[model samples]
Target: MTGNPAPAAAYKGPLPRATPETQPFWDGAKAHKLMLPWCEDCGQAHFYPRALCPHCHSVRLAWRQASGRGKVHTFVINHKAARGFEDKVPYVIAVIELEEGPRMMSNLVMDETPTPENVHVEMPVAVVFDDVTPEVTLPKFRPVR
Candidate 1:
Protein backbone atom coordinates (compact mmCIF):
# COMPACT_ATOMS: atom_id res chain seq x y z
CA MET A 1 0.00 0.00 0.00
CA THR A 2 1.02 3.58 -0.43
CA GLY A 3 2.35 5.26 2.69
CA ASN A 4 -0.89 7.15 3.15
CA PRO A 5 -4.01 5.67 4.65
CA ALA A 6 -7.65 6.59 4.10
CA PRO A 7 -8.25 10.27 4.66
CA ALA A 8 -9.33 11.18 8.15
CA ALA A 9 -12.74 12.73 8.77
CA ALA A 10 -12.39 16.51 8.69
CA TYR A 11 -9.94 16.79 11.60
CA LYS A 12 -12.15 16.11 14.54
CA GLY A 13 -9.09 16.62 16.67
CA PRO A 14 -8.63 19.85 18.52
CA LEU A 15 -7.09 22.29 16.11
CA PRO A 16 -4.18 24.34 17.33
CA ARG A 17 -5.10 27.89 18.17
CA ALA A 18 -2.32 29.53 16.29
CA THR A 19 -0.81 32.60 17.88
CA PRO A 20 1.76 34.79 16.19
CA GLU A 21 4.56 32.80 17.73
CA THR A 22 3.12 29.46 16.59
CA GLN A 23 1.58 30.46 13.27
CA PRO A 24 4.72 29.72 11.33
CA PHE A 25 4.86 26.25 12.75
CA TRP A 26 1.27 25.50 11.75
CA ASP A 27 1.95 27.02 8.37
CA GLY A 28 4.91 24.73 7.87
CA ALA A 29 2.85 21.71 8.86
CA LYS A 30 0.19 22.73 6.38
CA ALA A 31 2.93 22.68 3.79
CA HIS A 32 4.10 19.25 4.99
CA LYS A 33 7.34 20.54 6.44
CA LEU A 34 8.61 20.44 9.97
CA MET A 35 9.66 23.90 11.05
CA LEU A 36 11.42 24.20 14.40
CA PRO A 37 12.61 27.10 16.48
CA TRP A 38 16.33 27.61 16.57
CA CYS A 39 18.25 29.82 18.92
CA GLU A 40 20.87 32.10 17.45
CA ASP A 41 22.64 32.68 20.74
CA CYS A 42 23.30 29.03 21.63
CA GLY A 43 22.81 27.62 18.12
CA GLN A 44 20.36 24.99 19.28
CA ALA A 45 16.87 23.82 18.26
CA HIS A 46 13.75 23.55 20.39
CA PHE A 47 10.07 22.47 20.19
CA TYR A 48 6.72 23.84 21.46
CA PRO A 49 7.26 27.09 19.58
CA ARG A 50 8.43 29.26 22.41
CA ALA A 51 9.78 32.79 22.00
CA LEU A 52 12.81 32.11 24.19
CA CYS A 53 15.23 29.28 23.78
CA PRO A 54 14.71 26.75 26.48
CA HIS A 55 18.40 26.00 26.76
CA CYS A 56 19.95 29.46 26.87
CA HIS A 57 16.89 31.64 27.58
CA SER A 58 17.77 33.72 24.53
CA VAL A 59 15.26 35.69 22.49
CA ARG A 60 17.22 35.22 19.31
CA LEU A 61 14.95 32.61 17.75
CA ALA A 62 14.66 31.59 14.14
CA TRP A 63 12.64 29.07 12.19
CA ARG A 64 14.35 26.30 10.30
CA GLN A 65 13.25 23.20 8.38
CA ALA A 66 13.88 19.96 10.24
CA SER A 67 15.06 16.72 8.64
CA GLY A 68 11.86 14.99 9.77
CA ARG A 69 13.88 11.99 10.86
CA GLY A 70 13.94 10.86 14.50
CA LYS A 71 13.78 7.85 16.76
CA VAL A 72 11.06 6.90 19.15
CA HIS A 73 12.49 8.02 22.46
CA THR A 74 9.50 6.77 24.37
CA PHE A 75 5.84 5.91 23.80
CA VAL A 76 2.67 4.50 25.24
CA ILE A 77 -0.05 2.30 23.74
CA ASN A 78 -3.06 4.43 24.48
CA HIS A 79 -5.94 2.05 24.98
CA LYS A 80 -8.34 4.86 25.58
CA ALA A 81 -8.45 7.99 23.50
CA ALA A 82 -10.18 11.32 23.80
CA ARG A 83 -12.92 12.81 21.63
CA GLY A 84 -11.39 12.97 18.18
CA PHE A 85 -9.28 9.83 18.64
CA GLU A 86 -11.93 7.38 19.73
CA ASP A 87 -11.96 5.71 16.34
CA LYS A 88 -8.27 4.96 16.52
CA VAL A 89 -8.13 2.71 19.52
CA PRO A 90 -4.91 1.28 20.85
CA TYR A 91 -2.94 4.00 19.18
CA VAL A 92 0.54 5.14 20.09
CA ILE A 93 1.49 8.42 21.66
CA ALA A 94 5.20 8.84 21.37
CA VAL A 95 8.00 11.29 21.99
CA ILE A 96 10.47 11.44 19.15
CA GLU A 97 14.06 12.59 19.44
CA LEU A 98 14.70 14.42 16.22
CA GLU A 99 18.14 14.28 14.71
CA GLU A 100 18.32 18.00 15.43
CA GLY A 101 18.36 17.28 19.20
CA PRO A 102 14.80 18.26 19.98
CA ARG A 103 12.04 15.98 21.20
CA MET A 104 8.48 16.35 19.96
CA MET A 105 5.38 14.53 21.05
CA SER A 106 3.31 13.07 18.20
CA ASN A 107 1.27 10.07 17.22
CA LEU A 108 2.80 6.86 15.91
CA VAL A 109 1.24 5.32 12.80
CA MET A 110 2.12 1.72 12.22
CA ASP A 111 1.68 -0.49 9.22
CA GLU A 112 0.16 -3.28 11.24
CA THR A 113 -1.22 -3.63 14.70
CA PRO A 114 0.89 -1.70 17.18
CA THR A 115 1.91 -3.81 20.11
CA PRO A 116 4.52 -3.52 22.79
CA GLU A 117 6.45 -6.34 21.12
CA ASN A 118 6.78 -4.49 17.82
CA VAL A 119 7.23 -0.93 19.10
CA HIS A 120 10.45 -0.46 20.98
CA VAL A 121 12.46 2.36 22.40
CA GLU A 122 14.86 4.08 20.05
CA MET A 123 13.15 2.61 17.01
CA PRO A 124 13.93 4.57 13.87
CA VAL A 125 10.99 6.49 12.48
CA ALA A 126 10.19 8.86 9.64
CA VAL A 127 7.63 11.59 9.24
CA VAL A 128 4.38 11.15 7.31
CA PHE A 129 1.93 13.95 6.74
CA ASP A 130 -1.74 13.33 7.46
CA ASP A 131 -3.96 16.05 6.13
CA VAL A 132 -6.70 16.02 8.66
CA THR A 133 -8.18 19.14 7.16
CA PRO A 134 -7.46 21.58 4.41
CA GLU A 135 -5.73 23.90 6.84
CA VAL A 136 -4.13 21.29 9.12
CA THR A 137 -1.82 18.46 8.29
CA LEU A 138 -0.37 16.62 11.25
CA PRO A 139 3.07 15.05 11.24
CA LYS A 140 2.93 11.52 12.50
CA PHE A 141 5.76 9.01 12.72
CA ARG A 142 6.02 5.49 11.36
CA PRO A 143 8.70 2.82 11.36
CA VAL A 144 11.29 3.40 8.70
CA ARG A 145 11.64 0.90 5.91
Candidate 2:
Protein backbone atom coordinates (compact mmCIF):
# COMPACT_ATOMS: atom_id res chain seq x y z
CA MET A 1 0.00 0.00 0.00
CA THR A 2 1.33 3.42 -0.94
CA GLY A 3 1.27 6.34 1.42
CA ASN A 4 -0.60 6.20 4.72
CA PRO A 5 -3.03 3.40 5.37
CA ALA A 6 -6.69 4.36 5.59
CA PRO A 7 -8.00 5.04 9.05
CA ALA A 8 -9.98 2.18 10.48
CA ALA A 9 -13.30 2.61 12.18
CA ALA A 10 -12.83 2.37 15.95
CA TYR A 11 -9.09 1.96 15.87
CA LYS A 12 -8.11 -1.18 17.77
CA GLY A 13 -4.42 -0.34 18.10
CA PRO A 14 -2.56 1.38 20.88
CA LEU A 15 -3.16 5.06 21.38
CA PRO A 16 -1.06 7.57 23.23
CA ARG A 17 -2.37 8.89 26.47
CA ALA A 18 -1.58 12.56 26.89
CA THR A 19 -0.16 13.61 30.21
CA PRO A 20 0.26 17.14 31.59
CA GLU A 21 3.85 17.19 30.39
CA THR A 22 3.01 15.82 26.98
CA GLN A 23 -0.22 17.66 26.19
CA PRO A 24 1.53 20.30 24.15
CA PHE A 25 3.21 17.74 21.92
CA TRP A 26 -0.11 16.01 21.28
CA ASP A 27 -1.81 19.34 20.69
CA GLY A 28 0.80 20.25 18.11
CA ALA A 29 0.38 16.94 16.31
CA LYS A 30 -3.38 17.42 16.20
CA ALA A 31 -2.66 20.69 14.42
CA HIS A 32 -0.26 19.01 11.98
CA LYS A 33 2.79 20.51 13.61
CA LEU A 34 5.79 18.81 15.15
CA MET A 35 6.62 20.32 18.47
CA LEU A 36 9.44 19.43 20.84
CA PRO A 37 10.36 20.44 24.30
CA TRP A 38 13.36 22.74 24.25
CA CYS A 39 15.62 23.29 27.19
CA GLU A 40 16.03 27.00 27.69
CA ASP A 41 19.20 26.53 29.69
CA CYS A 42 21.17 24.17 27.44
CA GLY A 43 19.32 24.99 24.20
CA GLN A 44 18.70 21.34 23.47
CA ALA A 45 15.54 19.63 22.28
CA HIS A 46 14.05 16.43 23.71
CA PHE A 47 11.28 13.94 22.99
CA TYR A 48 8.93 11.94 25.25
CA PRO A 49 8.26 15.19 26.99
CA ARG A 50 9.19 15.31 30.62
CA ALA A 51 9.41 17.76 33.48
CA LEU A 52 13.15 18.33 33.20
CA CYS A 53 15.60 18.43 30.38
CA PRO A 54 17.45 15.20 29.91
CA HIS A 55 20.66 16.88 28.85
CA CYS A 56 21.11 19.60 31.42
CA HIS A 57 18.66 18.47 34.06
CA SER A 58 16.96 21.85 34.07
CA VAL A 59 13.34 22.67 34.75
CA ARG A 60 13.39 25.47 32.23
CA LEU A 61 11.67 23.98 29.23
CA ALA A 62 9.59 25.45 26.44
CA TRP A 63 7.74 24.13 23.45
CA ARG A 64 9.25 24.90 20.09
CA GLN A 65 8.19 24.19 16.53
CA ALA A 66 10.46 21.57 15.00
CA SER A 67 11.52 21.44 11.37
CA GLY A 68 9.95 17.98 11.17
CA ARG A 69 13.07 16.90 9.35
CA GLY A 70 15.27 14.04 10.53
CA LYS A 71 17.42 11.12 9.50
CA VAL A 72 16.91 7.49 10.36
CA HIS A 73 19.36 6.76 13.13
CA THR A 74 18.43 3.10 13.07
CA PHE A 75 15.44 0.89 12.26
CA VAL A 76 14.04 -2.60 12.06
CA ILE A 77 11.47 -4.30 9.88
CA ASN A 78 8.85 -6.00 12.02
CA HIS A 79 7.66 -9.28 10.60
CA LYS A 80 5.60 -10.23 13.62
CA ALA A 81 2.44 -8.22 13.98
CA ALA A 82 1.60 -6.41 17.14
CA ARG A 83 -1.88 -6.30 18.65
CA GLY A 84 -3.29 -3.90 16.07
CA PHE A 85 -0.67 -4.18 13.37
CA GLU A 86 -1.41 -7.54 11.80
CA ASP A 87 -2.13 -6.07 8.42
CA LYS A 88 0.95 -3.93 8.65
CA VAL A 89 3.52 -6.63 9.14
CA PRO A 90 6.96 -5.92 7.72
CA TYR A 91 6.53 -2.28 8.58
CA VAL A 92 9.52 -0.21 9.66
CA ILE A 93 10.01 1.13 13.13
CA ALA A 94 12.74 3.73 13.21
CA VAL A 95 14.56 5.90 15.63
CA ILE A 96 14.61 9.29 13.95
CA GLU A 97 17.29 11.76 14.88
CA LEU A 98 15.57 15.09 14.46
CA GLU A 99 17.52 17.98 13.05
CA GLU A 100 16.95 19.86 16.27
CA GLY A 101 19.00 17.19 18.11
CA PRO A 102 16.75 14.65 19.82
CA ARG A 103 15.91 11.12 18.81
CA MET A 104 12.37 9.74 18.87
CA MET A 105 10.92 6.37 17.96
CA SER A 106 8.10 6.32 15.41
CA ASN A 107 6.78 4.30 12.55
CA LEU A 108 8.35 5.00 9.19
CA VAL A 109 5.54 5.08 6.63
CA MET A 110 6.68 4.44 3.12
CA ASP A 111 5.25 5.01 -0.33
CA GLU A 112 6.48 1.58 -1.34
CA THR A 113 6.97 -1.77 0.30
CA PRO A 114 9.30 -1.57 3.27
CA THR A 115 12.52 -3.53 3.06
CA PRO A 116 16.15 -3.28 3.95
CA GLU A 117 16.77 -1.85 0.49
CA ASN A 118 14.09 0.80 0.91
CA VAL A 119 15.01 1.83 4.44
CA HIS A 120 18.43 2.23 5.98
CA VAL A 121 20.42 4.18 8.49
CA GLU A 122 20.92 7.85 7.65
CA MET A 123 17.89 7.91 5.36
CA PRO A 124 16.36 11.35 5.27
CA VAL A 125 12.74 11.64 6.33
CA ALA A 126 10.01 14.07 7.17
CA VAL A 127 7.13 13.96 9.56
CA VAL A 128 3.52 13.17 8.63
CA PHE A 129 0.52 13.12 10.89
CA ASP A 130 -2.06 10.38 11.11
CA ASP A 131 -5.34 11.39 12.65
CA VAL A 132 -6.35 8.01 13.96
CA THR A 133 -9.12 9.54 16.03
CA PRO A 134 -10.74 12.87 16.64
CA GLU A 135 -8.70 13.27 19.80
CA VAL A 136 -5.43 11.56 18.91
CA THR A 137 -3.03 12.11 16.04
CA LEU A 138 0.19 10.17 15.52
CA PRO A 139 3.44 11.56 14.18
CA LYS A 140 4.91 9.22 11.64
CA PHE A 141 7.73 9.65 9.12
CA ARG A 142 8.09 9.21 5.39
CA PRO A 143 11.15 9.09 3.20
CA VAL A 144 12.10 12.51 1.97
CA ARG A 145 12.01 12.62 -1.77
Candidate 3:
Protein backbone atom coordinates (compact mmCIF):
# COMPACT_ATOMS: atom_id res chain seq x y z
CA MET A 1 0.00 0.00 0.00
CA THR A 2 2.98 2.29 0.23
CA GLY A 3 4.70 1.97 -3.13
CA ASN A 4 6.01 -1.16 -4.73
CA PRO A 5 5.07 -4.44 -3.09
CA ALA A 6 7.67 -6.00 -0.88
CA PRO A 7 9.66 -8.82 -2.41
CA ALA A 8 8.60 -12.22 -1.17
CA ALA A 9 11.24 -14.30 0.53
CA ALA A 10 10.34 -17.35 -1.46
CA TYR A 11 8.30 -15.98 -4.29
CA LYS A 12 6.01 -18.78 -5.36
CA GLY A 13 4.53 -17.00 -8.33
CA PRO A 14 5.51 -18.04 -11.79
CA LEU A 15 8.58 -16.09 -12.86
CA PRO A 16 9.10 -14.68 -16.31
CA ARG A 17 11.58 -16.44 -18.51
CA ALA A 18 13.64 -14.05 -20.55
CA THR A 19 14.40 -15.23 -24.04
CA PRO A 20 16.48 -13.39 -26.59
CA GLU A 21 13.56 -11.20 -27.58
CA THR A 22 12.65 -10.19 -24.03
CA GLN A 23 16.05 -9.97 -22.43
CA PRO A 24 16.24 -6.27 -22.88
CA PHE A 25 12.86 -5.80 -21.23
CA TRP A 26 13.90 -7.82 -18.21
CA ASP A 27 17.16 -6.00 -18.00
CA GLY A 28 15.43 -2.65 -18.14
CA ALA A 29 12.94 -3.66 -15.48
CA LYS A 30 15.82 -4.58 -13.19
CA ALA A 31 17.11 -1.08 -13.68
CA HIS A 32 13.66 0.39 -13.05
CA LYS A 33 13.19 1.39 -16.65
CA LEU A 34 10.21 0.56 -18.83
CA MET A 35 11.57 -0.36 -22.21
CA LEU A 36 9.39 -1.09 -25.22
CA PRO A 37 10.11 -2.48 -28.62
CA TRP A 38 9.68 0.01 -31.41
CA CYS A 39 9.21 -0.85 -35.04
CA GLU A 40 11.69 1.15 -37.05
CA ASP A 41 9.64 0.68 -40.19
CA CYS A 42 6.33 1.94 -38.81
CA GLY A 43 7.67 4.04 -35.96
CA GLN A 44 5.21 2.45 -33.56
CA ALA A 45 5.88 0.86 -30.21
CA HIS A 46 4.74 -2.62 -29.23
CA PHE A 47 4.65 -4.83 -26.15
CA TYR A 48 5.34 -8.49 -25.50
CA PRO A 49 8.69 -8.05 -27.14
CA ARG A 50 9.29 -10.07 -30.23
CA ALA A 51 11.87 -10.33 -32.95
CA LEU A 52 9.51 -8.90 -35.59
CA CYS A 53 7.19 -5.97 -35.25
CA PRO A 54 3.57 -6.93 -34.89
CA HIS A 55 2.52 -3.77 -36.66
CA CYS A 56 4.57 -4.19 -39.82
CA HIS A 57 6.07 -7.68 -39.50
CA SER A 58 9.44 -6.04 -40.00
CA VAL A 59 12.47 -7.36 -38.23
CA ARG A 60 13.77 -3.83 -37.98
CA LEU A 61 12.94 -3.38 -34.33
CA ALA A 62 14.72 -1.42 -31.63
CA TRP A 63 14.36 -1.13 -27.89
CA ARG A 64 13.52 2.24 -26.47
CA GLN A 65 12.70 3.54 -23.02
CA ALA A 66 9.01 4.13 -22.49
CA SER A 67 7.27 6.85 -20.52
CA GLY A 68 6.09 4.34 -17.92
CA ARG A 69 2.75 6.08 -17.91
CA GLY A 70 -0.53 4.47 -18.95
CA LYS A 71 -4.20 4.04 -18.24
CA VAL A 72 -6.15 1.06 -17.10
CA HIS A 73 -7.99 0.10 -20.27
CA THR A 74 -9.80 -2.73 -18.50
CA PHE A 75 -9.32 -4.91 -15.46
CA VAL A 76 -10.59 -7.77 -13.34
CA ILE A 77 -10.83 -8.06 -9.58
CA ASN A 78 -9.71 -11.59 -8.97
CA HIS A 79 -11.46 -12.90 -5.91
CA LYS A 80 -10.16 -16.33 -6.71
CA ALA A 81 -6.51 -17.02 -6.23
CA ALA A 82 -4.33 -18.79 -8.73
CA ARG A 83 -1.34 -20.91 -7.79
CA GLY A 84 1.34 -18.85 -5.98
CA PHE A 85 -1.17 -16.05 -5.53
CA GLU A 86 -3.22 -17.38 -2.64
CA ASP A 87 -2.12 -14.60 -0.31
CA LYS A 88 -3.08 -11.99 -2.85
CA VAL A 89 -6.72 -12.77 -3.29
CA PRO A 90 -8.90 -9.98 -4.57
CA TYR A 91 -5.98 -8.63 -6.54
CA VAL A 92 -6.26 -6.70 -9.77
CA ILE A 93 -5.20 -7.93 -13.16
CA ALA A 94 -5.42 -5.13 -15.65
CA VAL A 95 -4.85 -4.44 -19.29
CA ILE A 96 -2.91 -1.19 -19.35
CA GLU A 97 -2.88 0.95 -22.46
CA LEU A 98 0.57 2.48 -22.44
CA GLU A 99 0.98 6.01 -23.70
CA GLU A 100 3.19 4.59 -26.41
CA GLY A 101 0.08 2.98 -27.97
CA PRO A 102 0.41 -0.60 -26.89
CA ARG A 103 -1.60 -2.46 -24.30
CA MET A 104 -0.01 -4.93 -21.93
CA MET A 105 -1.42 -7.05 -19.14
CA SER A 106 0.07 -6.58 -15.69
CA ASN A 107 -0.87 -6.53 -12.04
CA LEU A 108 -2.35 -3.26 -10.86
CA VAL A 109 -0.86 -2.44 -7.48
CA MET A 110 -2.94 -0.18 -5.33
CA ASP A 111 -2.07 2.10 -2.45
CA GLU A 112 -5.15 0.73 -0.72
CA THR A 113 -6.79 -2.65 -0.75
CA PRO A 114 -7.85 -3.48 -4.30
CA THR A 115 -11.57 -3.26 -4.82
CA PRO A 116 -14.06 -2.39 -7.50
CA GLU A 117 -14.23 1.12 -6.12
CA ASN A 118 -10.47 1.43 -5.88
CA VAL A 119 -9.82 0.57 -9.50
CA HIS A 120 -11.64 1.69 -12.61
CA VAL A 121 -11.31 1.92 -16.34
CA GLU A 122 -9.14 4.73 -17.68
CA MET A 123 -7.44 5.12 -14.33
CA PRO A 124 -4.08 6.79 -14.74
CA VAL A 125 -1.17 4.71 -13.56
CA ALA A 126 2.59 4.53 -13.68
CA VAL A 127 4.92 1.59 -13.78
CA VAL A 128 6.48 0.11 -10.61
CA PHE A 129 8.95 -2.68 -10.42
CA ASP A 130 8.54 -5.67 -8.15
CA ASP A 131 11.90 -7.21 -7.45
CA VAL A 132 10.55 -10.69 -7.04
CA THR A 133 13.98 -12.20 -6.99
CA PRO A 134 17.57 -11.17 -7.24
CA GLU A 135 17.48 -11.98 -10.92
CA VAL A 136 13.94 -11.04 -11.85
CA THR A 137 12.04 -7.81 -11.54
CA LEU A 138 8.42 -7.80 -12.65
CA PRO A 139 6.84 -4.61 -13.93
CA LYS A 140 3.57 -3.67 -12.23
CA PHE A 141 1.50 -0.51 -12.03
CA ARG A 142 0.06 1.76 -9.38
CA PRO A 143 -2.27 4.70 -9.48
CA VAL A 144 -0.45 7.85 -10.48
CA ARG A 145 -1.13 9.69 -7.24
Model 2: per-residue Cα lDDT over 1-145, one tens digit each: 1344466685777998989999999999999999999999999888889999989999999998999999999999999988988877889999999999889999998767898888889999999998887788889998997
Say which prediction, candidate 1 or candidate 3, comes out ahead on TM-score: 3
Candidate 2, residue 29: how far the Cα is off, in Å:
0.6
Model 3 spans with C-alpha error above 4 angstroms = 1-8
lDDT of 1 at 134: 67
The TM-score that candidate 2 achieves is 0.93
CA displacement after TM-score superposition, residue 30 of candidate 1 (Å): 0.6
Query: What would the TM-score be for candidate 3 when compared with the true structure?
Result: 0.93
Q: For model 3, how does the per-residue alpha-carbon lDDT over 1-145 read when each residue is reduced to its tens digit? A: 2354556676889988899999999999999899999999999999899999988899999899999999999999998998999988889999999999999999988757888888999999999888888888888998996
**Model 1: per-residue lDDT, tens digit, 1-145?**
1365546564577876789888898899888899999999999999889978989999999999999999999999998887887778889999999999999999888878789999999999988788777667788898896
Report the candidate with higher lDDT, 1 versus 2.
2
- Provide the TM-score for each candidate, comma-separated: 0.92, 0.93, 0.93
Model 3, poorest ten-residue lDDT window? 1-10
The per-candidate count of clashes, in order, stands at 0, 0, 0
